[model samples]
Target: MPKTFYQFLMTQRNPESYDTIANFANNAFLDSAFPKQETEFDPLSKYLEENAPYLPSMTIFDDAWQLYLASLA
Candidate 1:
């Protein structure tokens, strides 16, 4: 089975590459309203843009997302 977004983020391939994203994922995991299961980008993007503890560049998200998509295959 494919991992959830939160699951994927928490499972680090390279600890250094995901430092910021892992921090955000930790935060997101705590939030009751976070859409942890949804794989679609737009809602997740909006949530990250608005609710992140610190603003991470969209490029970081895009790269993470590409990896997530590949994992689904």
Candidate 2:
């Protein structure tokens, strides 16, 4: 079975430049409402923007999304 997004994320080396995303991912591991199963970026981005407005930037999510997509290849 494919791993959940959060599961896949946890295996990643946390990027130093994107510490907030790493922190968010760590916290997301505990959020039952986080869409861990979703593969698309839109909903995931929306979730973060709405639920985690404190994140300083979305660049990390964009970077991580690229990594996630590459992992599938």
Candidate 3:
């Protein structure tokens, strides 16, 4: 069977919880209070690292929209 997006994200071993952090950052981008400058990326990254420490455990809850788009080819 093919690996689901959640499975792919879960299998990432480096940076430990990058997928989780990425998800949080993506959500922040949709918020009205989200910063428009690139400089805010680091702060958001830190926030996810600190607040969502169990990002890996929540893998199934996160959807891989980008992966779905890539599959259209």
Candidate 4:
């Protein structure tokens, strides 16, 4: 089966090679608050690492990030 967005994020061994972060970072998809542009993307990965404890155990990074943004609204 194909991986869900969350599974992809959680198991991403090399975020640099991952495509979504690059795409999302472009065209204001990601907020300016993001620490770095996609060229130097690690904060997203670091965010997953730092918040791993509090985030849901389910594999759904997209939803997790969405809710996080929603909280800011």
Candidate 5:
């Protein structure tokens, strides 16, 4: 698997909301708030909800996350 978000993409081929999505994930990872080992469900979605009060709206997170996943395909 990729080590970092940048490495994961390995290219600029992403949707318009890619940066926003990546920023959140990278920050969450860097801040030790991302549950990297959680296998029961989607970590990104969980992180976004857990940090909703401290970050932007869930709509943005949801959109960006979906776009990011699409870009990976």
Candidate 6:
């Protein structure tokens, strides 16, 4: 059997990680556009707007990975 898109993405190497970061950023923006409810930290629109400045820098997989780790702490 062949690897699916998700499987391929998960197994990507070095420079290919940048592409995965881009895809994750795109999906996050799309999902946040139509959020189910709103709250202080949960306000999708505001969160997206505030994070817009970081988008360009986020193109790097390492930066995006760090951001994800920071969010968890």
Q: List the residue pairs that clash in candidate 4.
A: 6-61
Q: Could you say which candidate leads in TM-score?
A: 2
Single out the weakest 10-residue window by summed lDDT for candidate 6: 3-12
The per-model lDDT (C-alpha) reads: 0.71, 0.72, 0.41, 0.40, 0.49, 0.42
Model 4: per-residue Cα lDDT over 5-56, one tens digit each:
3333334334355444333333123333333332112456565456444333
Cα RMSD for candidates in order: 3.2, 3.1, 12.0, 14.0, 5.6, 13.5
By how many angstroms RMSD does model 4 differ from the true structure? 14.0
Off by over 4 Å in 2: 13-21
Candidate 5 per-residue lDDT, tens place, 4-56, comes to: 33333224333344475555544554555445444222665676577645346
For residues 1-73, what per-residue lDDT tens digits would candidate 2 score against the true structure? 6555666677763546456657656666666778878877889899988886545678877877777777777
Better of 1 and 4 by lDDT: 1
Q: What is the lDDT of candidate 2?
A: 0.72
Writing each residue's lDDT as its tens digit, candidate 1 over 25-70 gives: 5656567777778778899889878877554587777777888888
lDDT of 3 by residue, 1-73 (tens): 4444333433333443455545544444344443333223246345445555444543322343354335434
TM-score of 3: 0.26
Q: Could you tell me how far off, in angstroms, the CA of residue 58 lies in candidate 6 after the best superposition?
A: 16
Q: Model 4 lDDT vs. the true structure?
A: 0.40
What would the TM-scores of all predictions be? 0.67, 0.72, 0.26, 0.25, 0.44, 0.25
Clashing pairs in 1: none
Sliding window of 10 residues with minimal summed lDDT for model 1: 12-21
**What stretches of model 6 exceed 4 Å from their correct place?**
1-18, 33-63, 67-73
Better model by lDDT, 2 or 5? Answer: 2
